[model samples]
Target: MAVTLQDKLVVALSSRALFDFEEENQLFEEAGSQSYVQLQLTRLTQPAQPGVAFPLVQKLLRFNADGQHRVEVVILSRNDPVSGLRVFHSAQENHLQIERGVFTQGRTPFKYLRPLGAKLFLSVNESDVRQALEAGFPAARVFPDSIKSAEANPDEIRIAFDGDAVLFADDSERVFKERGLNAFQSHEAQYAQTPLPPGPFVPLLQAIHLLQTLPANQVPVRIRTALVTARSAPAHERAIRTLMSWQITIDEAMFLGGLEKGPFLQEFEPDFFFDDQTRHCESAKYAGPTGHVVHGVANPR
Candidate 1:
């Protein structure tokens, strides 16, 4: 079928999905120029076996259009026999177009490393994803049918973000930073009891929310959101209350308390991760694509 701009897409494949290089590359290069881009590449010492829950790749391939445009898969791997074999099998079995190429070569045991070959990986973390979307790549992660039905159209692109610095003003962070943790916590506690001010990304969130609420026939754009943050337990109460006050419904929420975001994010398989802090963003980038260091209000865009 002929490809359409509406059908155009960019996706990242996990190391586990790759099976072969030569075959997969041929398919992708032939699929369409400028239609596919590889975000990360790494060589694996051991090839990924099928039926092992290659969640990242599975998420990318789940959405299918009117067959007008086929999903292209980019397998970023180093020169490893096992990795190549894995990519080969994934493409054939899943009907995915694959692109295989060497991203980095070294003796290090870590086959999959970040910032590989100059391409970027989108992280599932709310902050990381927020930065990536704002930076411009909205179609970073692909949503499967199951996830789509829960909200509305599974085929429509979905993007998520955190509250504070991401969707709203970094005022919360500022309060904590300048006033001290206790002061910040008290401020949040106060606002937690009442409605808080709107955030910087509020406009964008409203636009997306409108799209989701539109009738199926009239909804041309497909976008969804979730609020995943580190505000734990009682601290999270405020953020939740504010969201309710705004009448915005996040599809999913994770209030992890200073925990490693990689594993949980792996489940969501977000297209990108955005955060002001490099610590969380660094880990998230490895698991998925990530965008770093959003310029805050002080910097002034």
Candidate 2:
């Protein structure tokens, strides 16, 4: 029988998203591919330091500590196969239980998300992330700017999500983009009883909510989810109704209108946060690990 990832919550991430490759990336940018390859080869024995997404990945993998294998993290990178050797080595050195990877040698790596049954794909490259979103996975462009909230809660896994585009379909967002806020609000109000179509991250949220339903004693780890979105009041009603229609319950929901989400996210201190627009992601990153879901009308790139 062929092996399958159907039953597991798979996270496919890029090498740079998992480990610090900035110095090597700089070499690749300035010198060339050959320099980057040589540097990776030379440093193959030296484990790379943890990158921004490491904390989130590490904690996520911890779900399998009891041998249930509920989570799997795979390296899906654009790095050459030779550099992949170093990625695996670094994972081993850091004691991260990552057992699988694909090194595309500079080819776009997002195409492999389906075979892996990836619930989420994280990469520093916006193009790969965009492609993954188009492929219908909860993909995000990770900001390697900083590792926010290093002091993660040992027993709880906290994930925050934006409403439109990230969790719900970008339909209303497109309306807002082309038709203005009043039109957007009215559209959502009209559809308050309707469940918005699933967005890129819906599967991820569904998988997580499923896990949340598991008996606490059986899982041994607690999952705390949040909807930190920009839709406020009248617009917010639709988002709430959508989740209600789906029977998904997030622990917290912040309808921040148009206020800066950074400080509020800081108070929440999530292990990871997802947003569709760059400005929101820019603000959220200051509070926690941020993933840019470059989907919908808000992100034209």
Candidate 3:
């Protein structure tokens, strides 16, 4: 039996995560788009090349309508070398396919970019990805660490997020960022065991959480979550204690203090990462897909 959309697993990829674009660009320009697409299609169909590491993107040339899942490749620039390869692999994968033609002058044609059907396109920047997602296209990055192939079951769609501002109130964060470290520490200390107000996205979190907590036979599809944040060591103890106090179970937790979150995020491979700060989101986006930013206490200066 063919898998339905709800039963199928899907992933969307950005250009940079898919292949070595800078080096391939020169070759792509030399070969021209038409020839390059053909060559890529040929390579995708061949068995995995020897010496290739894990997370290798194999190419496919057919789309399976019954599955309802599809691959979309958002090409950021005209010179993106990964575009052709993405298209080639989509065809071979039997996933529903959509390709936004080159955003370049030549403009390569793709089968899907329609609003009504499954959405797929090439995004040039963070704004582009945001707009497409807002417009209903599922956005994804191509980093190897971003995809948890082992844990991902075809029957479920798993999504994750950070706790503060994303699932709970951002007031504490606002106090910390504006008042300085000491003030922030004091506020947390006062509220040490106290429960803070919930954030705007709490309802969404609850909905997903409800689905996750449902019986396996009742829901048939699983949804998982984790609390990946930068609050570490001593400060981390509070957040951990807070979650325990609330009786919430976070699948994973990382209390990285002032650390670049890309590496750890690659391991989580969440479908989306939502943060109030652009700095963290900017780096996180490179490792995996992200969702709309939820405002925190401090406004961007």
Candidate 4:
């Protein structure tokens, strides 16, 4: 018999995504790992400030509060072993029960997601996030400066996602980008009955759905998910149909068309928001913790 994450919703997080490490990161960038290691060592006893994704992680860990082990959060970082000591210490000081970690020094840690059975990966490193996405994992590069989640709704875990190029494949997004809005609307209208292809975040959504299906008393916190997309009216039908086809229920769906998503998301008050386009993510950061899913047509290199 072995300890298993098979039945858990596993999330792999980078050190920087979990705590405020900008100053140390800057040292690592300008002065290299040695200086960074020294700085982390000196600050080892001081708990780092919570980063953008901190609130979300706190709520997610609540799933395990019922003593069922329904959720697992692991530190998968590029920092060396010495730097990792500070990360663990910060988690302890912050009262987060994060117990597992993998310190890879300067190496990319995305490859470890598979063995960990992680459904989601959140990191501050763009290169690592991109690599995770390319490898078919739902990953996002967290905005370090994004607004923190509100203290209200302590019992609920609110998460929001962009529709096209995030939860759904960017086929419609490609059409919209290449042709005019008329063509994109027409395409979606014609295929209203057809289920849109799944995107990178689909696995993460399914995992959440699974957690939602668990007995209400088995999990300490409630999960509320939303699809906040730019698609409107006629095009929205297909996105709805796609989720119906997958049998996944989104608690809220905002068809914003082309309006800015920031205000709407602020009202939604999600613990975290994910969007493929940097523009949407930029707007969303003002609302709460935002992650840049640098995938699909909008992220052309």
Candidate 5:
């Protein structure tokens, strides 16, 4: 039988998002791909440092530690095959068991997500992330400088998501953006019984929820999730209803209304946080590893 990733929670990530390639990336930006390739070749033996998404990836990979292969991590990079050598080496140095990779050599890499059965995609490149999200896969543009996750929960994977645009459709957010908060609040309250549509991250969240439901003895690590949103009170009801309707449960939920998400996220100390708006991501990054989901009305084309 042909090998398949159908049952595994596959996460496709870019090289830059996985490792600290900022200096080499700057060289690529200022000089060119050739110079960048040469530099990577020169440092081929030196492993790169872990970047923003590293901790999250590390924890997710733990699901496979029991030899059940419940998770798979793929390097979907724009770097050339030469640079990819360095990436794989870095993974080895960091003790990450990443085996699959697709080095596009500057071509767009999102197109490969479908074939890879990727549940999530993380990249430092906004274009790749937006394209992946547009293609209906959960993708996030990781803040390269975002603070790393706290070491408080090594055996547990904690992920936090924004409600609108990240986990639920941005319909209410559209109203909030165009009409005003009152209209948005009214819309959500009136449709409190109605479940909002699934956003880009729904599939990923569903997969995580399924993994969390596995018997403790069958899994290698614990998974916890949260819904941290700006919605409060009446507006919050719709978000909760939506999750209930989907039959998916998160470990925690924070309806902060319009408060800055940073402080709350700091307390939660998630391995990663995903939000649609860049402003929210900006504040959340300081709390822990954060990704900007470039979708919905707030991120207009």
Candidate 6:
């Protein structure tokens, strides 16, 4: 029988998002691919530091122990095939159980998400992230320099997501962006009984929810999720009702009302946080690992 990833929690991420390739990336930017490849070859034995999503990926893979493979992480990168040797070498050095990869050599890698059945894509390139989201995948642009989550809890995995344009469709966000806050609130108020449409990250949330429902003895690690959004009060009602409709219950929810999310996120200390706007991503990174969803009307062409 052919191998399949349909049952796995598939995540495809770029080399930059998985490990710190900033120095090599800068080289590729200034001196071109040849120089970058040569440098990588020379330093193939040196393990690259973990990137922003490192903690999250590391913690998630922990679920695969005890003869179970619940998670699958792949390297979907634009690096040339020759340069990819280093990526695999680094993974090996770090003991990351990643065996699959797609090196596009220069092309957009988002095209392969369909074949992989990937539920999430994380890349350092904004364009790739936008392309993936446009292709209907839950994708995010990771900040390579963002502070990785402190490993305070080894037996649990914590994740957080922005509400609109993330776990829920950007309907309210579109209204807010085009008609201002008052109209956005009123629109949500008028339709408080109606659940917001599903967004790209819903599948991810559902997957996590499934893991949470498993008996504690069945899984080695605990999973906790939170809804961190800018919506508050009347607008917050629609977001809550939407989750209620889906029958998914998260551990926590925050409606900051245009306030900085960084401080609040710090208290939660998620291994990773995903948002759809640059402003929030910037602030959230300081608290923990952060990624930009790059979706909805907020990221219009």
Give the Cα lDDT of each candidate: 0.48, 0.89, 0.48, 0.92, 0.92, 0.89
lDDT of 1 by residue, 24-59 (tens): 335445873222223113322233343211333344
Q: For residues 150-217, could you state the per-residue lDDT of candidate 3 as single tens digits?
A: 23334544345665665566777778677876787777776677766765445445444544665565
Give TM-scores for every candidate, taking all chains together and pairing residue i with residue i. Answer: 0.47, 0.97, 0.50, 0.98, 0.98, 0.97
lDDT of 4 at 224: 95
Residues 180-239 of candidate 4 have per-residue lDDT tens digits of 899999999999999999999999999999988878867778999999998999999999
Q: Could you tell me how far off, in angstroms, the CA of residue 187 lies in candidate 3 after the best superposition?
A: 2.6
TM-score of 4: 0.98
- Tell me the deviation in Å of residue 180 in model 2: 1.8
User: Roughly what TM-score does model 2 have, to 2 decimal places?
Assistant: 0.97
Q: How well does candidate 3 match the true structure, expressed as C-alpha RMSD?
A: 8.3
Better lDDT candidate (1, 6): 6
Which ten-residue region of model 5 has the weakest summed lDDT? Answer: 149-158
For each candidate in turn, give its C-alpha RMSD to the true structure in angstroms: 11.3, 1.2, 8.3, 1.0, 0.9, 1.1
What is the lDDT, from 0 to 100, of the residue 60 in candidate 3?
14
Best first by TM-score, ranked: 5, 4, 6, 2, 3, 1
Model 1 lDDT on a 0 to 1 scale: 0.48
Model 6 clashing residue pairs (backbone): none
Tens-digit lDDT track of model 5 for 1-301? 9999999899999999999999999999999989999999999999999998889888888887778898899999999998999999999999999999999989999999999999999998899998999999999999989999647688888899999998988887889999998999998999999999999999899899889999999777799899999999988898988899999988899999899999999998989999999999999989999999999998988
